[model samples]
Target chain A: MIKKILILSIVLSTFMVAKTPKEIYEKNCVECHATLPSSLEKMFMSYIKTYSGERDTKIAIKTFLKKPDLDTSVMSEVFLDKFGVKKPTKLNDKELDSAIEYYFNQYKIKGRLN
Target chain B: MLVSRSKDINLFRQSEKVSLIRFLVLYTILVASLLLLISIFYYQSQEKLMYAQYTKLLNTYANSQIKKLKNLHHYFPQQTRYPRSTKFKSAIYDSEESRIFSLLEKEPQYFDNKIYRTDGKIHLVHTLDTYYLGAKYLIIEVDEDRTWLENTLKYILILGAIAFVILSIFGVFFVKLFLKPMRDAILLLDDFIKDTTHELNTPISAILNNIEMIDTSQMSEKNKKRLTRIDIASKSVSLLYQDLTYFALGHKMQKKDEEIDIKALILNRMEYFFAIGNSKNIEFILNLEEVYLFIDKAKITRVIDNLVSNAIKYNKRNGTITIDLTPMGFSVKDSGIGIPKDKIESMFDRYSRFNNTEGGFGIGLHLVKSIVVEYGFAIKVQSSLDVGTQIYVDFRSKGYTL
Candidate 1:
């Protein structure tokens, strides 16, 4: 029991120190989104098409993640019917901000156009 | 004859210079406005052609972007990076006119027009049929190449200068052409006057000499009055002839300056006009102070004769003629048909006649003015209609000795 508690404490400390925005996004968002019909980039493009700019797109995505709502989702009703609304995210504000920033940077269309 | 014609032309040129300048100004403005209009049209056409070429090229760029986006959507669905190029900057807008992505230096404010320029950069907006990457409007921007504009402006400047030079040459030719008839008429009138003056000289001298020889001492009062009238008429003709001769040839005459007693000169001129003044029952009141001046004798005589003659000619019957001769200047005040205030300013202009009832040419005061101006003297006139006229010649500038 003492060895198990020491090992658990070490793992918790390691997670606290080692979790970057990219790691957090990949662990929390990608784990579930990877199984969806649309890729994470496709959903981001949907957000971009609806919300347009970086700040609005990020706020929109964060709002939907914080409180899963069908009215605010950029996805179509057909897609929503196939795979119901997503669950609200459990990340705190600071963590959520960093994760959203990482997600925006990952799929943003700026600088990639030839 | 050729010399006289050339002299007449020179005189005419001097008098008509103001007219020529007016014509040149009007002509230059007309031609400049025409050139400006042509330049504007040329610039607009050139800009339109350049824009058409740019629109075609930018449309192709937009088509290429659409193709790339389509390929990305179909084959590279998981591709994390968007396509890009270094040739130009671009932006994509969704169906709702919201920007999906942009690499442009400036965001476009208007989308109604397909292409436009702003901040020295050209932007071309092309609509896409397919919503590749959800982009409904593609805006392509590039730095506007201004070499064509610079070249067009240079061409316009060079052409405009050449056209102006050509037009000025034509304008001068047209002005001369337009004035040719007037010049010919003036020359003809001048020759007629010269001939008339030459013919009248001998007869006038003969009449004056013959009249002086006639014995009026033994004649009847009526005969004596007739003789005096003939004498007065002949002298009037003689004075007119002298004025015409001077007008025709005064510029070519040599100056003979001498010191003369102005008081004596006035007295002598007054004697000459005494009979004419007497015929009108005009009284002469002389207020002469001894004054002397060094000037051309003939020119000064003309000035004095004109002033005295005008006083007599314009004076009312039984009117007073006041002659004032001072060290500085002289004045001739007459109770005559006074000049209107508006006419006084132009009274010294050649052939400017105010009283048509007066029997004399209008050259008297104009000749007086010419001689006064030549001697750097000033003339002042004060007259009121139906009251009287007074003319003063200020000779202080000529430094008259007392």
Candidate 2:
């Protein structure tokens, strides 16, 4: 009976997982950044768009986000002035990269915007 | 003063007393020296023991205080207060005076089995030497605690003094006790001399009288020879009697320091000994200087009598006796059996004799030695066995010019 219940749970959880990049971002992110402010979000969207067009989009976005220098930072001076410093995203390097990938594919001009 | 007077009695004044005293003196010196050394060592050791005990007491006090402070530290590591006990007063320090602690409510004193100045309360502080956790952080002061040592020393000194007094008493007692036998011996000897001299007095006179009364005209040649032998025997006894008297009383002879004609005295004594000298067929050769000396007459006569008679007695048959008297000294030389070298030193000891054949009781040289020493004179003997003996009496040549 325990084996049959475990098999049922594994199969049900696989269907709930995001199958594409858009779904990955929708499922994992959106809570902190979506409501933060438009200016900050727009800056973050630009960095995603710029790095997402590259052939090695995962590597480029992952390195940039993990240790963001002032030159590579996506946040504007206005937003930084309002909030004196941005808290570091707690997601690991690979997780943040994957999330960024999912966000880029969902919002890309070519992809579905919803 | 009375001791000095008694000490002044010479052995010559009474020879028996002198010998007894000499023996006692030697014994006392030896015993006193031994006791004095032993007593000093004993007293010093006692004094040292007292000091050692005093030091031990101080150490005990320090150890007890240290132990208490360690306990206090265990209970109250940061407590700056310490309880004051009647038994001790203490001071504590911690970390170079970063913290100083005391446990005395007031000064502490232990006197006459009572504690004083205790403040009737406890004092508290916290100080410690963290560098050495075992250091004495507390020192307890006991007023006049050192009195234990001082009293010990005082009692030791008193004991030493008592011991010294006791030993001194013993020394005196033993000295007198040890001399008792010698004293008794002297008294017995004196009684014997008194009785024997009295007994000899009668016989000597009787022999002389009988010799003189014998009619030699009617007797034969054999009878004359017998009479001469009796005469010689009488003279020998007379000489013996004179010597015994000299030995017994001669030391007390006064130093009259009279102007003495040395040459005349020698001739007179030589004449007295001529008969004995002739009996031994001994010839005399005299070379006398007209010298005078300042000395006791009786002592010089005794010295002369001993030397001349000994020469005659020990002379060879028809041997020569030479008497040479000068301003410097006089020598009596005899051609007879010479003294053995080993016996020469003891020759002057009373009754020390080398010749068993000689009729002397051996007091002759001993008497000569005593008289010579009394007058600050020196006598040297030179001898070879079966050859001869020479006695040189070196008078104070410079002092005896008179």
Candidate 3:
């Protein structure tokens, strides 16, 4: 009876530990983009505004998130001097896409609702 | 010192009996380790190659698209048919050259193409690499399906696994087949030892019997002495025959463990040895305790015949041979050229001999030892080099009950 109970507990623990795709995204990158809602137009606008003067935003963001780099951040020297350089968020491609869409809808076009 | 070939040959790390098993186990481990190492290397290198190929194909698509896009701008700069072109599922056009194109071939909707916002639509584009040139990025408006490189890697791994398993099974079978001849040779050698011991009984009997029938009364004194020596040679042959027979065929002998009068059995064996003893001028001093033992008469006869013949053959001329039989056991002592100190231990070993002068194949004491051992009796031999030799056979105390 004790052996059966132990085996059941082990199997239950594994299921509990398993993460869904949404949870994986939330844990890895939700800190930065969790407040944003999902929208493709808003996402594109947010990307433009976020890296206003950046040379290569798509390639830079993809490479940077996979392997972070402070030297390539699109934030201006004046913004970084005030806020201190924002840390680049780490995420898998799938999770990053979800977060990216969320940021676009929330910050980029939140004013367009009116 | 005995030189053993088994000790000298250290080709393998174990004895002959277990060498093949050990070799099989080692070979299995080696093959498994090699397979594991190769699989790991192949997995790592193949994964890298696949990724590189994917990147290369994607790059090829991007480069070809850029080349065509440049040519189109050169030829028809104002053509709004760019979006309708089949080169890209969805394409964004910049005023000068900036464009993001998505390939239509993908299983699930994941990626999108977008031209970044810049001052006056500055035509800045980036190229990517992939394993398949036909498909790179997918467009949201177009849906296509064909992933060739991923399917290729999957097939390669599956086929490699099947080939490895089949080859490993064949290797195990071949190893077993290769070891079969050596195993058969050892079995044949054991059979040869048994057969050779069985073939020695016939001629040995004929020689001993002819010597017994010799009459020395008509011969001269020198000839009579030679006859006596011949008699000793014959008894030695008889002893050897008894030992070999006891070793090979003793176990199959019928046993009748009746109450045997030990004194009478000793006296009968003494009579058998008298002819050889007479030729040697050896005197017999019988000291019988009239004891009884429980044993088969035929086996007891073999044991007594071997011991008495030994005493007579090694006895000096005119020497006294004594036989003392009791419930405890029997003892035969002779004043003759006694066994060498070094040879006493091996006296019970088959074909172990100390004296070259005495005619003996050296199987007598070996036979005596075997009979005593079979009946749970103990025999001890004691000798002084020039004095005499004494052999004592002690049947265990339980022999008295029967």
Maximum-lDDT candidate: 1
Candidate 3 docking classification? incorrect
- Over the stretch B252-350, how does candidate 3's per-residue lDDT look in tens digits? 456667778878877776666787788878899998987877777767887888788878778889999888876677889999888888888988987
Residue runs of model 2 more than 4 Å from their true location after superposition: A1-114, B1-144, B209-215, B252-261
lDDT of 1 at B170: 93
Kindly give the stretch of ten consecutive residues in candidate 2 chain A with the minimal lDDT sum: A105-114
**Could you give the candidate ranking by TM-score, starting with the highest?**
1, 2, 3
Best by DockQ: 1
Query: Candidate 3: lDDT of B117?
Result: 18
Clashing pairs in 2: B12-B251, B12-B252, B80-B125, B80-B126, B81-B124, B81-B125, B82-B124, B82-B125, B93-B128, B94-B128
Clashes of 3: 14
- Which runs in model 3 stand beyond 4 Å of their true positions? A1-114, B1-232, B337-344, B354-359, B400-402
Single out the weakest 10-residue window by summed lDDT for candidate 2 chain B.
B1-10
RMSD to native for every prediction?
Answer: 7.9, 23.7, 20.1
> Candidate 1, residues B290-315: lDDT per residue as tens digits?
98898888899999999988988888
Give fnat of each prediction, in order. 0.20, 0.00, 0.00
lDDT of 2 by residue, B242-267 (tens): 67766654544445789999899998
Better of 1 and 3 by DockQ: 1
Instruction: Sort by lDDT, best first.
Output: 1, 2, 3
Better of 1 and 2 by DockQ: 1
